[model samples]
Target: MSVVAERPVVAEESRAVRWWRRPWVGPLALVVVVFVAVSVPRYLTLDPAQSLVPPVEGFAPYYPMLVAHVLFGSVAIVSCCFQVWPAFRRRYPVAHRWIGRAYVFAGVLPAAVLATVIGAKSPFGPVARVSNVLLGLVWFGCTLAGWRAGRARRFGDHRKWMVRSFVLTISTVTNRVWGVVAGVVLGPQLETTFGGNEQYMTSTIAGLTTWLGWVVPLILAQLWLDRRPKKRARAAGRSGVPA
Candidate 1:
């Protein structure tokens, strides 16, 4: 009798497991968590003096609105970390639906509204003010579009719009990162060019980064979304499958 060689068995990974293992997911989630941890504590004290932005003249509600915006934005960002997680969505679809509702209603909606109000009176100068207002509106619009797409059972469009919304939601974190970088690079020039006006220096950096933070990432996201179909078609062709 001839001895037949047996093939080694390799268990296939589940879809959820595969998605969880994607390189970007864990690190991105961790970054968002770290951002929340670092950025939220000051606001939690509810002291107006602890506010990041200076109070605008005659705007008594500025601090209150800032506090609300930060808290609600924290909710939106934290919840959205899971919202974009394919593993979580694939494994617990029911929970996903509920979380999506929370993300929309309890997080983005309120946060965006307050953001718009706060942005309108921002002390970061006209450029920063316009950037903030536009960011708020676009963020709100993307989230609303995502929710409507889901309601209409257009999962693909829903995913795209949600991804856009989430990117906008996290732009604040990006803004801070950009601000720090710009400060480091620009700090030495403050004495020479800005006449030691820290507020002016800060406003300049904030204005530039506020635009960069959302605009750059948003462009990259749109490019990715546009290319995704081409990538799929290529893969399908390689596999002799119809896309």
Candidate 2:
């Protein structure tokens, strides 16, 4: 009857008819990029001295650790891509279910390893340690929360948390994206700021942005998506979508 009354119907129908631009594609491309940019090179070239961070306790004998690192990194990269299937795309609960388990083991687990590998460099400034710890917590916390929410049969909450987790996990891929940009743009200034590890810092900054950029934005997105305007649900039911 009014513009307000007509607005939602138009929005909903428009949303339903859309294609060619699903949210999953961005992350899918990210997964591929991670493999190409980070994983492949790290694998083909196994030099402990060249590793971006110091070796962990078990990750010593850099060769083996590097191999494992590449392996796990691959898992985290791939897992984050499939983590969001049922929503905004054709539902693939069957793949999502199995992939969900692998994600926890692959994606979240390797991140835990990175936490150790990258240890707290408090003297090097808070960014490295803080980022490492926070990244691990985000990866673990989000995945766990998503799992628990789904187990409780709260689908909406589950989806939101899972999206949050996947966003955090994808920071690995995002790190590379930012790393290249910063190095290309700030190549000379890096040695001045972080000593000689300018490229390393660029990479680190990129990885961290995956959290600062994608994950945080995702949380804001969830809040925005969840904010139903209070009246929309009732209106949707009245308009025949059955809420």
Candidate 3:
């Protein structure tokens, strides 16, 4: 067969083997949903002095950190929405690389550093502080790894690591959702656990959610990636192709 004829056949086969039809559409929808659901309220309602857990009234660094976290995190979230879209990646590889660079350096890195600082200042105690630091470190490291992989031209590794990093970044949205649920469920028990000190009770809840929010999404991503190869192999076998 001629190379030109084979090209279309190969492209068609690639599309047929894909995990989803138009995967970008669903995720793009989700990206918008998450922005509306979490990011909007976060900035709109932010009042440093009235912050529930950290109580930012007396702090200087906290203000800058808070601003950096919100702005840089927004950049990361929006950049990732484009980064993961198949149409964007395939049709605009140059743009993909640029956005990925911004996502890592201008977005995740700054956000994670500021987060570590803010987490260290947690008013609740050591538990919240440790979780925050750990989460920030992991976020920073995963994003850096993805960038390095892209530079090395290991595109598969780049995608996997970038997906993992994006999942961690979006924990900002998940963290808030979990916090609301915890507040409602644990409202009556605040006095029982913290001697009626609402500040400490809020602190405890924040600390727990900090760990749960990032950890859960990462675990789910790991499971999905691990299954991907096996699923692809099964598909290939059914099609009488060598896995």
Candidate 4:
């Protein structure tokens, strides 16, 4: 009798395991955690002196609004990490829905409203103010759209809009990263270009990074969204399924 060679058996990976193994998921979670840890504590002290953005001279409510905005924004960003986690959504769908409700109602709604108010009167000057206002508006609109889509049971649209909102929510972290990069590049030129006026240098970097932080990520997200359909279509073709 001839001996036949047998193929090695391979086990399929679980959805939860696959999600954890994704290249971007762990790093993204770590970045958000680090950002929240570093940025939230100072605000929690509830001292105006510890405010990241200095209070405007004539704006009596600046500090309060800033505090509210930061706190609510913190909620949005933290909840968003869970909202986007595929494993969490797949394994614990009920928890996912409740968190999603919290993210929308308690997080984005109040935060986005406060963002607009604070941004409109921002002490960072015209450029930074404009960027902040626009960012707030877009963030609010995308979130509202996402929430509506979810309620309507249009999950595909919900996912796309929520992805947009999540990216905007995390743009705060990206803003800091860009701020550091801008500082490194512009710090040396402060004397030559800004006449050693630290305020002017600071404002310029803030304005530039504020725009870059959200816009760049948004553009990348749109590109990814656009390509997803093509990827699905190609996969369908390969599998002899209707696209």
Question: How high is each candidate's TM-score?
Answer: 0.91, 0.65, 0.85, 0.92
Residue 156, model 1: Cα distance from true site in angstroms: 1.0
Q: Residue by residue across 111-219, what tens digits does model 2's lDDT show?
A: 5565544534322345655666666666677778888898898988887887777666666656657656655766776677668785466555644554465455556
For every candidate structure, what is the RMSD over all alpha carbons to the true structure, in angstroms? 5.2, 6.6, 3.1, 5.5
Model 4 lDDT tens row, 114-175 = 98889989887789999999999999999999999999999999999999999999999989
lDDT of candidate model 2 versus the reference? 0.63
Query: lDDT of each structure?
Result: 0.88, 0.63, 0.81, 0.89
Error of 2 at 59 (Å): 8.4
Model 1 residue pairs with clashes: none
Candidate with top lDDT is: 4
Clashing pairs in 3: none
Off by over 4 Å in 2: 1-27, 30-38, 44-46, 49-69, 86-91, 121-125, 184-242
Worst 10 residues of 4 by lDDT: 1-10
Ranking by lDDT: 4, 1, 3, 2
Point out where model 4 deviates above 4 Å.
1-17
Higher-TM-score candidate among 1 and 2? 1
lDDT of 1 at 34: 91
Q: Model 1 scores what on Cα lDDT?
A: 0.88
Which parts of model 1 have CA positions greater than 4 angstroms off? 1-13, 16-20
